[model samples]
Target: MTLQLEDEQAQKLPFDYEELAKQVIDQVLGMEECPYESEVSLTLTDNTKIRQLNREFRKIDKPTDVLSFPLVDFQKPADYDLLESDGWEVYFNPESGELMLGDIVISIERASEQAREYGHSLKREYAFLIAHSMLHLLGYDHMISEEAAVMEQKQAAVLKKLNITREGE
Candidate 1:
């Protein structure tokens, strides 16, 4: 998997963010008949940049922890079909020769805040966010009650599998 990270604000994380992100992405991709070769872009920024993005894209006018921009529509089965099919519309990035999944934007500042607020290490919080955003890129959402349950379960399962506990174990 190709994870292009654009880290805007460099802060000392508990572990290497790139390696952790790749692991989370691998876990997500391994859950299904996924592509062995794919790409996803991640941007780590401050609250100010994320807030501007939130205001511009979501019109929220406030910074959120993370944002996901999926390349395909989740509701359609064709989205998955294209992954196996080698057609022109396979979401390929010719420049990198990898299937483009989507983009994830995360705010380090917000993640740190959330970690403290939730009584966890920043590493666990960042891993959770990366896992959560990876799922979102793979067509998971918590917009509704049922969907929220599924997503929450998936997130928890991933975290548990990775041993990224809430207590920072």
Candidate 2:
């Protein structure tokens, strides 16, 4: 898996945010058993920029912690066979040949605030957001109760596996 990460925040976080993103993304892909090599883009921005993105993409005029834009539409979550059957050549990068999974935009400012409000480390909050967005990229949604429960379980599992618990530093 290849993660193309960019930080656009004015004040960068003290921790190694890139490494944490990569770890969470890799763990999500592994857990989902994605067959093909994948590529994902992540941008770390501030509340103002993220709010603009949210307004443009989702028509919501508020800042959100993270936004996911999935490139491939999966019939079933994490089902690679469907991609092969459907012949989704449009979802692959010609040069890299990696499946272009999706793009993720995160608000560093919101994440920090949420971490403090939730009584967790900033690292843990970032991991949770990334994991949550990864699940969305892989065709998962939390619109309904059952789906939300599944997504919550997966996010918790990913953070736990990485030792990025709420109480951990």
Candidate 3:
């Protein structure tokens, strides 16, 4: 997998964000049984930039913790077969031969705030957000109650597997 990560935030966290993000992304894909090599881009920024993006794309004037932009429309979430069948040239990166999963944008400020609010470490919060966004990139959404529950379960599972607990363990 190729992770193109761009860190544009001024405030640096205590932990290695890139390493954690890669672990979470890889774990999510593994759990979902994605059969192909994948490509994902992640952007770490502050609330100001994320707010602008949120307003422009989602028409929501407020800043969100994270945003996901998925490239493929899967018949089922993490259905690699469907992705492979629907013209591989469109979904696969020409040079890397990796499936272009999607993009993730995270607000470092919002993540820290949420971690404090939830009484968790920043590492756990970041992992949670990345897992959530990775799910979105794989075509999973929480727009409905059932879907939300499933997403929550999956996110928790991913974090637990990585040993990223609420206590930052």
TM-score of each: 0.91, 0.97, 0.97
Clashing pairs in 1: none
Which whole-number lDDT from 0 to 100 does residue 62 have in model 3? Answer: 94
Give lDDT tens digits, candidate 1, residues 51-132: 9999999999998999989886655422476465555455778877787889999999999999889998988989899888
What tens digits encode model 3's per-residue C-alpha lDDT throughout 2-75? Answer: 99999999987899888889999999999998888999999999999999999999999998999999998877
Q: TM-score for candidate 2, please give it.
A: 0.97
Please give the CA lDDT of all the candidate structures: 0.83, 0.92, 0.91
Total colliding residue pairs, candidate 2? 0
- Could you tell which candidate, 1 or 3, scores higher by lDDT? 3
TM-score attained by model 1: 0.91
- For 61-159, candidate 2 gives per-residue lDDT tens digits of 999999999998987788887677656788899999999999999999999999899998888889999999999999999999999999999999999
What value of lDDT does candidate 3 attain over all alpha carbons? 0.91
- Residue 73 accuracy (lDDT) in model 3: 85
Give the Å error, residue 16, model 1: 0.7
Model 1 spans with C-alpha error above 4 angstroms: 76-79, 84-90
Candidate 2, superposed: residue stretches over 4 Å from native: none
Q: How far is candidate 1 from the true structure (C-alpha RMSD, Å)?
A: 2.1
